[model samples]
Target: VAKPVFMSCNDRQHSLAFGLPGMVERLNHLHIQYTDFDDLGVSHDTIRSKDIDVAMQLGKHANDQLYTFYSASPSGWLMELGWGNYEKPAAQEHYTGDIFGHAVEASGYGLDLEL
Candidate 1:
C-alpha cells in the first residue's frame, strides 16, 4: 500500500470531521474516494502501527466540538490550509490557546498542534 505523505493521522481524521462538506463536494468529481485508510479500518492506531510519520501523540486532552487547522509542517500548501506550526498569524490572534483539540462554548477551536 502507498503510505500517505503530506498528511498526519490527525490530519486525516480532522479532515474527515472538518472537511466533510468540502469533501462531499469533491466526491462528486471522483468516483473512488481519496480516503485511503478508512475502508481498511486504518484509523489512528492502525496508521501508527504501520510506523508511518502521521503524528506524534504528545498527550491527551479534551475540547468542545470545534474544527480548525494546524500549521503542521514547513510546507506552504498545508501550512496555508492549517495554522502555521510555530507562530500564530495576526488573523488568528483571537485564539483562546486551548491545548486540547476540542470545541469551547464560545468558539470551535480544536486541533492544538504547535506550529
Candidate 2:
C-alpha cells in the first residue's frame, strides 16, 4: 500500500487551506501539472486505511503570530508548513498550544496526510 502524501508550494499563504481536491484544482487553475503516487504506478485503492476525510485547517498558535498546518509525509513523518510569522523582530512571548484549529484528525497517526 502507498502512503498518503501531503504536498504544497512554499509560496502558499497561511489563509489558504486546500484539501486534496481543492489543491489539485488550484494547481490546475494555475496551469501547474502535478502527479501523485497513483499516477506513478501506485495502484488505486478504494478503501484506504489512512484516507484523510477532514481537511486541515489554518491554525494560530497561542502566541498568535505564527500560523501553520500539520500534514502526513510520504516518508512516514509529520510535516509542518507555516507562514505569517514575525520575521524582523521575534515574538517575545512563547506558548505551547494553538489558539484555535490545528486539531489532529488521524486516529493512529495524529496527522491528516491527504493533501
Residues 1-115 of candidate 1: C-alpha lDDT, one tens digit per residue: 2222222243222232222222222211101122333432333344447653322232222221222222222221121122222322343334444465423221112222232
CA lDDT of 1 in candidate 2?
Answer: 24
Runs with alpha carbons beyond 4 Å of true place in candidate 2:
1-56, 87-93, 110-115
Best by TM-score: 2
Q: What are the models' TM-scores?
A: 0.24, 0.38
Evaluated with lDDT, which candidate comes out highest?
2
All models: lDDT?
A: 0.27, 0.39
Model 1, which residues run further than 4 Å from truth? Answer: 1-42, 56-93, 99-115
Clashes per model (N, Cα, C within 3 A): 8, 1
Candidate 2, residues 10-86: lDDT per residue as tens digits? 43222232223323333111111123433211211221345633223446666534554544445433334444434
The RMSD of every model to the true structure, in order and in angstroms, is 15.1, 13.8
